[model samples]
Target chain A: MERKSIAIDMDEVLADTIKALIEEVNARTDLGIKEALLDGNKIRHFMPEHEGVLDEVLREPGFFKNLEVIQDAQEVVEKLSEHYDIYIATAAMDVPTSFHEKYEWLRTHFPFLDSQQFVFCGRKNIVKADYLIDDNPRQLERFTGKSLMYTAAHNIHNEDFERVNNWKEVEKYFLGNEEI
Target chain B: MERKSIAIDMDEVLADTIKALIEEVNARTDLGIKEALLDGNKIRHFMPEHEGVLDEVLREPGFFKNLEVIQDAQEVVEKLSEHYDIYIATAAMDVPTSFHEKYEWLRTHFPFLDSQQFVFCGRKNIVKADYLIDDNPRQLERFTGKSLMYTAAHNIHNEDFERVNNWKEVEKYFLGNEEI
Candidate 1:
């Protein structure tokens, strides 16, 4: 049987991006904002100056390279890869400069996946897959397939799609009681 | 009426890639290969050393940044953008390093189009649009929408799909009698 393809988002879904951003903020300033303090909101909301600082960091060349992977992401995604076709669909166009970093990041973290599995674009609606795993509700808005919302602090209130809080839940949703 | 989206290819369709590649070969070695002599084939097919030299060029940082645009592509694509939702889709995954250069190239040549319209991916099958105007037949193979094969020296023998010989024909096909 042909394995069903799954399009996975990189930022918060696979990589703990907000946490990294928060860390960058803490390292730069005395904001000392913990991930827990974010409480399902972006840093810009709590940032004192705001002034596009976070956006500026995102536009930097290496911001996306060293992002820590979400908990259990590697093992679960490897398991999922065995059962399904996996495509890493990232909206990298929003920060065009991050392309090389993001590509290198994916190559380092998701080494099993090749360049063919990467899709760097702005709009998620055009991605063809049996399922789209994303955190942003707007990214899932126009998707024609099954939408699986990956739980993140910022997207906690979005109740429109099936939510998977962590990689364990993702494995359960896709693999369903199969031992990993 | 909402404009029907067209996913246009960047290589042979919008940019004269093979011509540039041939030029690169002539610059390096004594292979006096001209675009017409090859008569619808790739640079590697005629290259004497053929030992991944062209692939090396493709993988370089700035190769895609300076290639010449296909004649009339700017005017016709600009005209098409007004009538159709234009998306510049390039298979940049084949050369991951080329992402930044490709984005910069697009920005320089097609400034009217924004980041939202750029898709740098490997598989053309995943791109959803009303029509995919491309040069590679394999790219059109899995596309579910209408496929228009843009003429190129290499793809001349391809008999599949409606062929658009040049940007003029592309304008004629889409805009028809409406002046471009």
Candidate 2:
């Protein structure tokens, strides 16, 4: 029997990229930008003056490597792995340094996922999977499969797809009454 | 209209990895193993005394980066890109260092191909496409697509799939009676 495949985005879906960005912003400058102020996906929108700050932060060697794992991501994904082909597909081309860092980070955090299950590419449109869970609506918008919007500070306002605010919600949606 | 997608392997199919291995063996050891003596995909078969030489060579920093490109791979792939959704799917997880090197090498050599077209993956079975051109019989064996065996020194003995000896044969099979 063919197992259903799920392609989960790394940055916002599994990794807390927004929290890291906020921490970096607060640490580097006196902007004191909080998560509440981060309304959209583009960091530049909140701080128009700091046009290149996001790019600078992304270019840092450990920016992606040091990101905190999302709550329950490891457990939920492991559960899903048993019933489906779980793929952690991340758009890592923007920062060349993040390639190996992300790979190591996945291995460190989600040891259950083998190296073969990781798909590091630039776009999500090329991915062929039965389901995609991502924070970016643009990625979900282009995906031909069932797109589940994983809530993030930047994507809270976007009501374009089926939303799953947390990993518990993800578990409920897929497993139905199964305990995590 | 949806274009037919073709997933092409990188190492032995597009890049001449055997040449690089032979060069590395000659440069590092006194055995001076030639291409004629190398029997299989694994280098350990030829050098029984140096059991870990293959792993050592693969772990080297520039092993995948400095590989020579297979003759006419660039031109044939470019021609194929005109009609099909061409994807360069390489099993890069064996060597962690290969992730970025393969990405950079693609950018440098196949300038026409964009970052979105490259799939740095582990198992080719996870890939979804209408056709797959690869040298590894294991990868092609499981792929649920039209598998075209790209002739490589290691895979030349395998007669499981339809064979394409060189880029000329590939062009003949695809763009028959049509000039590139």
Candidate 3:
């Protein structure tokens, strides 16, 4: 089958953004919690319960600079590239100084994320993509094609998007094989 | 002056979202320049340079859980309410669970924020407001009535929404110093 193009949102889907956010906050605040005690399932939206913990991290001199890539994002993206033209689309707006760092992170994580394929856009609605993988509920309306919503711990209100609980389901849906 | 309605976005204008985000990332990995050293002047979009830092911070848990509020947001919002109806129009989809805390934060910061006139919405573009104060670039197009762009470090793109930068300008353009 000829490869079709797919636009993927970077924050939560390709990157374990929420997880990283939580860790940084904990580290900054010097909070103590077992690693297993926190997971994707725990943090949803901006929970007040987590505010004290987060504030501790933010108070540190430079807490928001370092973030980690989602596990297996590179492998998943590479495999998907074999069957689809991939475009990285993020709503993270203009902060020109950070563009290179953001782009390089994508390349490092996805390995195949090249300049040609990546697009930092303000409006996801304007982009033309056959498929989109996103964690945002709003992005679902923007897609006319198959839009896969990566399942997250706190995506309760975003159940409207077609849910793919894990990489295996994503593989099955896009590649026609579920045993990922 | 008769009080009318108002809506606002939180990150840049109300709080130091970008600064905090940058700080959080740098602290975790020691990747790029320390958060304080970053000169965000020419940058339009958050790119690869910052991505390296972002990748590091994201590895930590609970980063986003601790986003800080804008400095003068409470005071400004209170003062604005003295002359207009105040509503919070945020693009943040995670407001439901976090609304109370956010609202309480606002109240703690400014008592006037509690007076029965605020709305927490996921889709600000679709919502109706007599006046809108936001930092997001695309939101300028979505607003119908008097739209004001809150000026801040990360919101340099908001220069595009120059018609209304502060309440003084908003009054000059929208209210016209005339009693409603």
lDDT of 3 at A56: 51
Candidate 1 docking quality: incorrect, acceptable, medium or high: high
Q: For model 1 chain B, where is the 10-residue window of minimal lDDT?
A: B42-51
TM-score of each: 0.95, 0.93, 0.43
Q: Fraction of true contacts kept, per model?
A: 0.93, 0.58, 0.00
Local accuracy of candidate 2 as per-residue lDDT tens digits, A67-144:
999999998999999999999888877777788999999999999899998987766766778999998888899777
Order of models, best lDDT first: 1, 2, 3
DockQ of 3: 0.03
* Tens digit of per-residue lDDT, candidate 3, span A1-180: 756878888777776656666666556554554434444344423455566664454344332235566666676778888878787776543232334445556656666655556654444543456788887666667555677888765564465777887766777788787465
Model 3: residues with Cα > 4 Å off, grouped in runs: A30-66, A94-97, A178-180, B1-180
- Estimate the overall C-alpha local distance difference test score of candidate 2: 0.85
> Model 2: residues >4 Å from true position, as ranges?
A178-180, B37-41, B177-180
TM accuracy, model 1: 0.95
Ranking according to DockQ, highest score first = 1, 2, 3
- Writing each residue's lDDT as its tens digit, candidate 1 over A80-141 gives 99999899999999888889889998889989987888999988877888899999998898
Distance from true location, Cα of B154 in model 1, Å: 0.6
Least accurate 10 contiguous residues by lDDT in model 2 chain A: A36-45
Per-residue lDDT for B64-151 in model 2, tens only?
8888899998998899999998988888887878888888899888999988888887777667789999988999997878999998
Candidate 3 displacement at residue B65 in angstroms: 33
Question: Considering just chain B, what TM-score does every model have?
Answer: 0.94, 0.92, 0.66
Root-mean-square deviation of each candidate, in angstroms? Answer: 1.8, 2.1, 13.5
